[model samples]
Target: MSLMCDARDIEVNVTWPGGPGTNQRLEKVPSRFAFAFENEDVKGMEEDCWGFGVPPGARSYGWFKLLLDKARKTEYDVEDVAGELTNGLLELPTDMTAKEVVTAYLTKIYNHCMEMLEQRYTANILITTPIDFWLTVPATWQAGAVDDTKAAAGSAGFGTRDGDTLNVITEPEASGIAILTEQAERNPELIKAGDNAMICDLGGGTQDMQILTIKAVKPQVQLEEAVPGQAGKCGSTFIDQQFYQWMEETFGEAFTNLPKTKIGHGSKFMKDWEGVKAAFTGAAPNKQYYVPLPALGQALGATGDHGVASTAYDFMDNAVVLSGEDVERFFEPVVEKAFDLVDQQVSSLRRRKQGSTKLQIICLCGGLGESIYVWKRFNDFCKDRFKGAVKLFTDKQAWSAVVRGAAIRGLNGNTVLSRKAKRAYGIGVHRPFREGIDQEEDSYHCPVGGKRAVGAVAWFIVV
Candidate 1:
């Protein structure tokens, strides 16, 4: 059966099976939400609500999932949440918590998808066919974050209709399903039973890796985890963060003191940077990239130095010139961390196999995985390390791999045989107290049998 799902990073990608004349449909919404309150007492007014890929103003919130993950273990406090908001280009109503902002953002995404579907087909299709939602989350997420995600999805109206369902899977697993399924269909011989492959999903917010061994290829593709997944905050967004830091450092107060309206989410300068970032490949070391800063120019006027003389940067024609070398520097540290994660996973796979087999393939997919430069770096590293023993592959539709895979998994059912747990799961219990082993504070009296015991844990699953 066809299904609807979304893969969320710095943006949310929604995909679903198409109607009679189409194959599939995809929509991308920035993980940004904005609300205009009529007054201090009102919030999320429908007329004042909107979402965009690059939000129109500074009041919108982006990268909120990361914020939620950070605050997962802490108690929710409005003031504390406000402090976290200050770190980013986020502005929220003082009364709203981070979770509330997330819920509103998700709800906006859901409504947008439904509106598209209704326009394509009749609205009656929504009522006749139950839409199952399959969401992808980062492997590094904690239990609290997962639960919160589910709650937000539900609150956003997913799985609320009759016969509808909601399912959540780690991002790496979802990408793996899509990449492996496509590979098996196109070149079955490239992967075989007993072969191992590493799937790296490099999105805007995080890089997640998983190693899986092909269990079977015929009839249907099957896979089992060769090792638990690994992830880090080494994603494309970190590149943006580094670039912003460089801007501040190179320009000094000229950049740092700019008004939010000039440099906020949808400003011309930010929009130009987005294009520059997307096209950067570090292929031309001597080339210079210019990002126009008309607003900054007007603010500083003709006499201002624009801080170019003191640094390696140049300001000409109201544009800031960045060298290819400087842009590559912004990407190196983040890319290195992703490479390290792959190294760790490969090392574990080698130890597990004990030389019986080697990593036969490396699958890269996600928004950042679409980078030519990233692919080149990975290709070079894999060639040197594997010595022509491994094949590096990337999907043509890397940006939507996770969402597409979620749709495929929903239609074909799960092909994974088993998965390794990242952490242990257990229940707390009371065991009969040992005379000297049990601490005095841990001992408890059992009323039913009048027995002394100490609190302990029974682990059902181990990582």
Candidate 2:
């Protein structure tokens, strides 16, 4: 799921990794595909390919994340984008085709995987091997986004050879499947055939929730969406923004006037501050968090750490200190919104099922989903609201759960029987109006056919 490479130049001869040979089949296990790209060769051309992967340089890719944050946005011309990867509505800095970029990312991952495969089995055998790729997508992504992704994958030559196929699923659903699958393996009775669960996937940049219904547990456990998934831009990444702004506001000009270099101390502080956040557990943190700002002295023209010579301003010997309360300022805004989304999901299920215990488990997975603070919050909310009737759980494989769960889907394509529609879908058409059957006021005259029809209404299935 995450590609952490230090940017090493790849070896010419492909070799397998230290693990098992690719030819060996391990039943009920997920495949490992990524090779650590060490920092020496870590920064690469593809790193700048639109912001999905790590950025080559440091200014935050605000626009990229902002674009994905929306469930519906300016639609891209699918054919145009597909035909020419670089051609699209949004401005792109690089001339790399979207497919070229996607393919490059895929190739980087698959090349390592192939090397690992070649280690156990011969490269000749691995060359013709058929592999399934399961990619994760946000539940709220529009069809256009998915279309673009598939087009990119196809351009990347994925699922092209014999027996090769691409598989896609909602991120939250995949995480849920991984957790539920493991639970069933440990305890056969973890979930019955008709049990239901809610999966809250809180990643670094997005929060997604899905309701799953267990279908069967015989040959292998199968599941499907019981209701539409919900998602938003609220994720752990926002906390970094919160912490950053808090520093600027607290220290006034000193923090605000820091150097704007991508590798500056300010940026390094943010990179390190993530650890501080992961350690947060709903507890009042330090009165003043201290950070050694090496970039500060240089930025203000201060020869030494003691003072800024140009402005004759004084400063700490080696660090800038900030209040813990200021660092936490941004957390509640994002957290509360996420809590509300979860509440909506719970309400929908209990309201829909009404009579019986429909939701038995609330599984949290993803980057933020692994947070002790969030896990506790959801657990406490579930216990207080559901009175311990609903269970709260997360997995040790939370970070990679989405990708692994996706692999499970690829292996068992039929695991999900059906998915709930996110919204009503229908087509506009003219129909004969009846006094009792139709609402007279709602009827409209069809200009083409000269027939009566309903205006601005979905005539098909309504969830």
**Candidate 1 C-alpha error for residue 392, in Å:** 0.9
Tens-place lDDT digits, model 2, residues 252-336: 4555565443322224555456556777676565455555565654555443333333222224554555455655565676677
* Prediction RMSDs, each to the true structure: 6.6, 10.2
Worst 10 contiguous positions by lDDT, candidate 1: 73-82
- Give one clash count per candidate, in the order shown: 0, 14
The parts of candidate 2 lying over 4 Å away from their true place are 1-122, 187-190, 217-219, 260-267, 285-289, 297-317, 322-324, 353-357, 423-463
Candidate 2 structure, TM-score to reference: 0.69
How do the residues 142-213 of candidate 1 rate in per-residue lDDT, one tens digit apiece? 777888888888999888889999998888988898888778877777888888889999887678899988
Off by over 4 Å in 1: 1-27, 38-50, 53-55, 71-95, 283-285, 300-303, 306-316, 353-357, 430-456
* Cα shift from native, residue 240, model 2 (Å): 1.0
